[model samples]
Target: MEEIFDECWNSKGIQVFVKRDDLIHPIISGNKWRKLKNYIQTFSLNEHSGILSFGGAYSNHLFALAFVGHSLRIPTVGIVRGEELIITSNPYLNQMNDWGMRLHFVARSLYRDKEIPSEYENYLCIPEGGYGSQAIDGMDNLVHELPSCDAIYCAIGTGATAIGIARATSVLVTGILTLNNRAEIEDHLKDFPAANLKLDDKYIFGKYAKSNADLETFCRDFYEKHQIAIEPIYTGRMFYALVDHIKNGHIAPDSKLVAIHTGGIK
Candidate 1:
């Protein structure tokens, strides 16, 4: 937990701190570790053949999973979305393949339905982007890792991290939506009726994984100022929204905000 001094928030009399989950590790850092912690803990080789998960060609989740599988000496399978993508499509995919994760490319049509191949029925299949009850349960400890603050900020991917933090704390949890998944996120929040979570999609900047010049500029400027790395996809939109809110007087004065740097900087 590090307190960040920025003129936008400072001028408004709001204290801003960033929970640097990105520094948790070089590979399995940030919410990747948080979301997968329980899945790894509950897995037993005797009970299950291996772990299977879904992702795209450059999925950070799959990359981290592959590393975890290699480190734990557990068999792992990754059902890649694009059938055209292969093990050598990109360096990230190549690294995941090198880590010994069986890369099974599936048709985009079938991947949409999240159909698990019949041969891996025995494997424990984590949902795409690690968004499931287990992943949400895995993030239960996020609140304990924070300093006292009035609000918590985090980028919503599977909605697990923000919801997990909201469930664990009474403070306001503001999730900046990086994509157009408000309904999906709301569905995930149904199980947690008392969660103090708010979803903001204003800063999506068109769609997920899409970056424009302004976003790139903010991310670059943010790094120059704070010396903390944040990519435009996840953490960038989050901090951008946080700064915008403070600058527009949306955040109350004297409010202490903690932003979770959920680590997408590969």
Candidate 2:
């Protein structure tokens, strides 16, 4: 955890700190590492033929998993969400391929089934965004590393990270939703106490992977001011929401808040 003393926070009479989970690793950083920890530990490389997971074209989950598979010498398959990515080559997909993760593009419809095709049934199947019972255990580990605060904030994709943190700690967990609806997140976190969790969808900036000029400008200015780079998909939206909450008096005066930098800048 790193304390960032900015005049913006001082003006609001709030103390702000960022948990630098992004610096945990170069590739498998932030919540990605936390979410994948138990799964990787439980499954032995020799026991399984390969590992299979689901994600979109620009998914940080796929990107991190590719590097993980390469480092562990495990054969990996990424069930890509869009079939168009097969013909269109981009840096993210190219890097996943280079890292030895076999790309299997599927139509968006079939991807929703969340099951490995019969041919790859033998491989270990990991859910989209790494949400599972094991993921909660893995993410619960993050609570131990965090400092006591009035509230904790993080970007919510699958809600696994926020739910895990909420379950493990008494601090109010504010999850800035990167998606359009909170229904999916609410469903995933149904087992947890609702009073401990707060979900906000106001900072999505249109939709996942979509950004506008204001968001871009804010990220640029934030980097110049704090020297911490945040991408639009996760961290940028999270910080944007945090600042907005503080400025609008949503966060109580003099309250300490810790924002989890969930990485995936690339």
Number of the predicted model whose lDDT against the real structure is largest: 1
lDDT by residue for model 1 (1-266), tens:
88889877787789999888898899988999889988999999898899999998878899889999999999999999898987889998999889999999989999999888899999999988887777777777778878888998999988888888888888999999989999988887787653589889999999888868999999999999999999999999999999999888889999999999998544
RMSD of each: 1.1, 1.4
**Error at 199, model 1, angstroms:** 0.7
Q: Report the C-alpha displacement of residue 59, candidate 2, in angstroms.
A: 1.1
Superposed model 1: Cα runs more than 4 Å off: none
Estimate candidate 1's alpha-carbon lDDT, on a 0 to 1 scale. 0.88
TM-score of 2: 0.96
Best by TM-score: 1
Q: On a 0 to 100 scale, what is the lDDT of residue 74 in model 1?
A: 90
Candidate 2: stretches off by over 4 Å:
none
Pairs that clash in candidate 2: none
Lowest lDDT 10-mer window, candidate 1?
Answer: 187-196
RMSD of 1: 1.1
